[model samples]
Target: MIEDMLRTPAAVQDAERHTAHNYHPLPVVISSAEGAWVTDVDGRRYLDCLAGYSALNFGHRHPALIAAAHAQLDKLTLTSRAFIHDQFADFCRALAALCGKELVLPMNTGAEAVETGIKVARKWGYQVKGVPAGQATIVVAEGNFHGRTTTIVSFSTDDDARADFGPYTPGFKIVPYGDLTALAEAVDETTVAVLLEPIQGEQGVVVPPAGYLPGVRQLCTERNVLFIADEIQSGLGRTGATFACELEGVVPDMYLLGKALGGGIVPVSAVAADADVLGVLRPGQHGSTFGGNPLACAVATEVVRLLATGEFQRRSTELGERLHAGLHALIGKGLVAVRGRGLWAGLDIDPALMSGREACERLMERGVLAKDTHGSTIRLAPPLTITAEEIDHAVAQLAAVLAG
Candidate 1:
């Protein structure tokens, strides 16, 4: 069994040698997955802590979601936006109801949903809010991880992600994350929206300061600017809630959702808002060929259902306490600190003890799997369906690694 894994498969090697080195994944090539674990090409199993950046909130190949996708595929897969399909309205209505919003604009990926949100905010700024065209600005937090679009990265403060990516896209202003003062001062007459993540996941799961979210929401309302929460990485029971904003009892004018919306089967994402905010887009302004396709719509409809039940959210909340407590036990030893919500937590490590990548490598060797973010932080975002025993076991492995 060990020998089989020692032999790198041809497919993995070829892709490594030829593909762009955008990501440095751990050295396990997964062949199948179920629940909270994944089997590698050599049939070795590991508890999945990353969970595709919270994309598998319902876990791998959830039976209900798969059934929906299969049932839809048997009927119709793609009708495109040229015409609607049977599943489209059901999915839209379901998601809209879940979001408690009047409208939904389905898309295929987090980036596209974010892009759609930006467009929607801008159009509303012009058509409704009466902002000047092309002069509209969106205030984004400094450490935000909205998506990897040219425009998204254009405003990024991370040198690695922003350097040489431009000239850069304009019409965006950046302020220090978690700083309400900066956000308050950044707004002007031309500001259309304040686009931000509830938790800065890509920035190593940085949680905002207390009262920050409610304050931002208030600011947007008072300033007549839309509040766009990019919950793509932090939503849908991943943060132990239907949406991360619930922790603060705040609601934004628009929500950007993705990752878990596909139930880990497909890439389905969407933006939700009231008609007054998102109604600016007419029939021809924007769309995608695969957006709201029958297959994705069907799959996403089930995904919303799973999240609606309080089960996933309750599990995440209960497990999150254990996960964080277990991780907190390691702080000031080998770990620097632990910060996150729900099933996702980013642990910062002592620089001299071990880098986050080294810790991840060690964890991988020890039969658990997780990934590093930024430089010295490892993000653990297991599925909400993960068992308590699995969390304890993974924590034990991490404890052993720290002890060493």
Candidate 2:
């Protein structure tokens, strides 16, 4: 307690003083982390349940990713889009194969991948789909947590992410998530693409109805529109599969990937699509300076390799069943509901007992780290590296917190 009072407060204050106050992070200041545990500055260790919002799906500084990064650092780090880099082609090939797509467009962040998808879809609409110029429309699901760029936020329904950010961009139609009828009504002749997160991670790890994704795919194909799945958080073995859409046997026209793509080491994102769709981009139309830099490609290449082995996916499937069983057992105790799949979960605390923020704060005090999304819903997305014993420990901590 003395160490926390003496050293931690100063460090926390210094951090708050220097940074923009956009994020409301928990009070603990983490200094180091390993597989599924992080040590705060005051020498207290906590089980990390959030896993950087699924960015650290492979856990902190995974050996393969670190080795790849270290080896590449010695050889090459950055070679902008101006010149061809050795690491670029391999990453693109590997990721494209993983997504069963013909081409891959590299980007630096999730938002960039999304923006790239939008541009490609619009271009494809005009050139290939024969849609009228400047009339391209993209249908998006409400409660999506796409990256907060000006254009991406334009179609957002979340007031917190949308308000005061205007004047907003247009060319998008919003539909209720998991409602095939609403989505169908939103799409028309001008619709070029339908973008959605297979499992809405930020909106409380909300999984849509069983047939909703398959229905979206059928509709997109029948309507001659591209279906884009934003798998930044729900992909790469997070949902007990390589991609959450695969859980429903749905393959989209494009995959917007990021977060774990960098192996949690660097910012890496990409858009995977067939040749005719991504080929719409000309040389100078869309590019990023550091999009497929050698370092990012080197690390992300290994990430693709790791997923190819299917070990993490297996772990997610088996451990996810256990995690869900544990959570489902606690439904009426303090949790009103539990939703999600694989290593990801969203627990809704009984609001009469406490808000999600308060429960997470209590979990923090009990040496477990989680995050709240809205109201009484808190999301848990532990790394796939977590063991069954660790899963039990985390569940036990939640039970104790609820009991108190």
The TM-score leader among the candidates is 2
What is the Cα-based lDDT of residue 163 in candidate 1?
84
Superposed Cα deviation of residue 121, candidate 2 (Å): 0.7
lDDT of each: 0.90, 0.94
Lowest summed lDDT across 10 adjacent residues in model 2 is found at 1-10
RMSD of each: 1.3, 0.9
lDDT string, candidate 2, 1-404, tens digits? 56556567888899999999787999999999999999988889999999999899999989999999999999999879999999989999999999999999999899899999899999999999999999999999899889899999999989989999999999999999999999999999999999999999989999999999999999999999999999999999999999999999999999999999998899999999999999988899989999999999999999999999999999999999999999999999999999999999999999999999999999999999999988899999999999999999999999999998
Q: Clashing residue pairs in candidate 2, if any?
A: none
Per-residue lDDT tens digits for candidate 1, residues 1-404, read 76664544665787698888887887788889999899887777899898899999888888898899889888999988999788889999999999999999999999999999989989998999899878999999888787888998998888878788788888999999988998999999999999999999988988898899999999999999999999999999888888999999999999999999988988999999999988888999999999988889989999888878889999999999999999999888799889998888999988788889999989988889998877788899998889999999999999998888
Worst 10 residues of 1 by lDDT: 2-11
Q: So what's the TM-score on candidate 1?
A: 0.98
Off by over 4 Å in 1: 1-5, 9-11
